[model samples]
Target: MFFLIWLVLFLVVVSFLLLLPASWHRAIYERYSGGRPVACPENQQPAVVSIDVRHAAVAVMDGRPNLRLSDCTRWPERSKCNQECLSQAIQAEPYKPGEVKAGRKQIYHLPVLLAAFAAWYVGAIWHSHYMFREQWLQAVGLTHAQVKQIVWWLSPHLLTAGVCLLFAYGVAWLLAVSHRKGVLQGVLMSVLLCGALIATTWFGIARLPHDLFLIEAGYIALASLTVGALVGGLYDRLVLPSQ
Candidate 1:
C-alpha cells in the first residue's frame, strides 16, 4: 500500500537523522584538524584550538600586546583570566554565531507573521473546494456538516496561526543553530524536519486514515518549505555580521 511505502521511507529518514549529529561533528573536526599533527608555538604549551570555517581559537595563552580582538576572545584562558587583564588585553567579545548580529534589530514579528499567513494560505488552498477538502473529509469519516461545525468560528483559524508561529520559531532556531542562511539549505532542513516529525507521529501513534494522513502531511511539508524559505532569505538580508 502507499502507506507501507511511506512507512519504510520514514524509517530510513529516522535512521539518517539519528546518524547526523555524529557525522556533522566528525566532518567539522576533519575539516579543521588535518591528518597531520599540529605543532605548538615556540615556548608555548600545547592547547586545543577550536576551529570553524570562519575562525579558530586557542585554549589558553598569555596576554600579548599585538594580538587582535578576534584572537583574544578565541583564547580559552580569556574566560578564566582576571577581568582587569582581560579588559586591557582584548577589545572585542567572543563571536557567537547564533547571537543577534551587531547593529541589526532582532524582530520576530515578520517571520512569525509571514509563517502564520503562509501556513494558513496553504491550508486554505489544500482544504478548499479546489483541492482535497471533500476527499479528506470522506477519508476521515467526517461529514460536511461536521466540518462546518468545526469551522463555524475564528477559533480554529487562531489556533492554526498560533501553531504555525510555533513551527516557524522551530525552523528559525534550527537555521540559527546551524548558522546556515540559504534557500536550498532552509528547504532541505524543513523537508527533513517535516518528514521526520509528521511521519513519526503518524506511524507511531494511533492509526490514521491513509488519505487523511497524506493530506495533512502534504500541507505540513509545503508550509514548512514556505516558512523556511522566507526565514532564510530574510535572515541573509537582515542579519549582518559584525565589522
Candidate 2:
C-alpha cells in the first residue's frame, strides 16, 4: 500500500513538473515586461524604451525618443524639446531589461555532497525525535517492530543520504535550467518542486491519514528549502563565477 501510494504520487508529480518550464518562461516574461504599459507623463516627449538584458528590468528613458535636430526644432520651447534634452538623451544609458541568462550546468560536488548530508541530518532529526516520529508511526498503523524492520531493510543512513543526494542534484539542475541563482531563488524553486513532487502525491492519494501526510510533507518541504539554500549559495559562490 505504501509503495503503491508513492508510485502513483511520483507519476503525478513528474507530469506536473514537466509542464513547469513553459509556465516558468511566461512568468519571467511578465516580470520583464511589467505586464502593462506605463501612463505617459504630461509635458514630456515620448519615452524611449530599451531592454537591459542583464538585470531583467525595463528602462523607460524619459523625455527622449529617437530624435533628429529637425524633429526637436519643429517642437520649440513649448514642446519641452531642446538641445539640452537631446544631449541628455544621447548620454543616457538605454533602459533595456536584461535577457534571461541560462543557468550553468556545472555542479560543485563538495558543496552538493555536504548539502545532501545536511538534508539527511535534518530529516532524521525532524522525523526521529524533533517532531513527528510517534504520531506518524501511530497514524500509519505501523508497530515499533514493523517500523524497525522496515528501517533495517531500507537502511536509514543509506536511504536518507541517497534520496537527499538525488534531490540536491535535481534542485541544482532545475536552477540551471530556469536561469536562476541565489539562496532565495533556490528556496523558492525548492518549494515549488517539493509542492509538485511530494505534496501533490500526499494530497492526491488520500489513502494516508491527514496527519501522516502533513507530517511527512512538512519534513520534505523543510528539507528541500534548507538544501536548496545551501546548494544555491554554493553554486553562486563557487560554480557561477567559473561559468
Candidate 3:
C-alpha cells in the first residue's frame, strides 16, 4: 500500500516537472515577446529592443530566466553597452544609473565547489575499511581482490565525486533562485531534494538488500545535510559577507 501511494505521488511529481517548463515557456513568450521600447541606461535615449523569448523560456528550467536583447535600435555601433535596459524593459521602471536591480542572484562557485568536496569526503569516509567497506562488498557480491582490480576512473569513487559536484551546483542554483540564505533554509531545501532521492530508492528495494539500502541512503542524507549547512549557513554568513 505504501509503495502504491509512493508510485502515485512520484508520477504526479514527474508530471508536474515535465509540464512546468512548457507552461513557463508559453507564459514568458506571451508576456515578453516582440519589440518593446526601452530607455537605454547609457544615454537615457529611447530605443526599441527585441528580446530573445525562446532563450529566456528555455532558461526558466534553471530557476531564473535569463533575459537578453536579441536586437536593439542602437546595435552594431553602441552594442558594446551593458544591457541594463533589460531590467527597465521587464519591470517598466525608469533606468537608474549605478543602481543594481533585484534580479538573478550570483551563484558562488567557491562554496559550491567546497560543498561538493565535502559530500565526496563524507562518502569516502562512509565506505572506508573502518566503516561499511566489508559489508558493502558483501552486499555487492564482490571480493576485495575483485574490487581492487577495477580501474580508478571506472570505479564508483569518480562517479560519486561527479554526482556530488552536480548535486552541490543544484543546491546552489536552488538557493540563488529562491533567494534563500542561512543554514536552516539550506538544510530545508536539501532535505526536500533528498526526500526525492529517497523516494526513488524504493525502486531498488527488491534488488538491494536492506543493509545495503540503508548504508547508501544514510550516506546520502548525511552528505546532503553537510552540503546544505556549509553552503547555506557558512557561506552565506561568512563568505558572502566578506565578498
Task: Report the number of the highest-TM-score candidate.
Answer: 3
Lowest summed lDDT window (length 10), candidate 3: 94-103
TM-score of predicted structure 3: 0.55
Give, for candidate 2, the lowest lDDT window spanning 10 residues. 68-77
Comparing 2 and 3 by TM-score, which wins? 3
TM-score of each: 0.53, 0.52, 0.55
Candidate 2 local Cα displacement, residue 90, angstroms: 19
Q: How many clashes would you count in candidate 2?
A: 11
Clashing residue pairs found in predicted model 3? none
Q: What TM-score does candidate 2 reach?
A: 0.52
Q: Cα deviation in Å at residue 153, candidate 2? A: 3.5
lDDT sort, best first? 3, 2, 1
User: For model 2, how does the per-residue alpha-carbon lDDT over 159-188 read when each residue is reduced to its tens digit?
Assistant: 779989988888888776665667987887
Cα-based lDDT for every prediction: 0.58, 0.61, 0.76
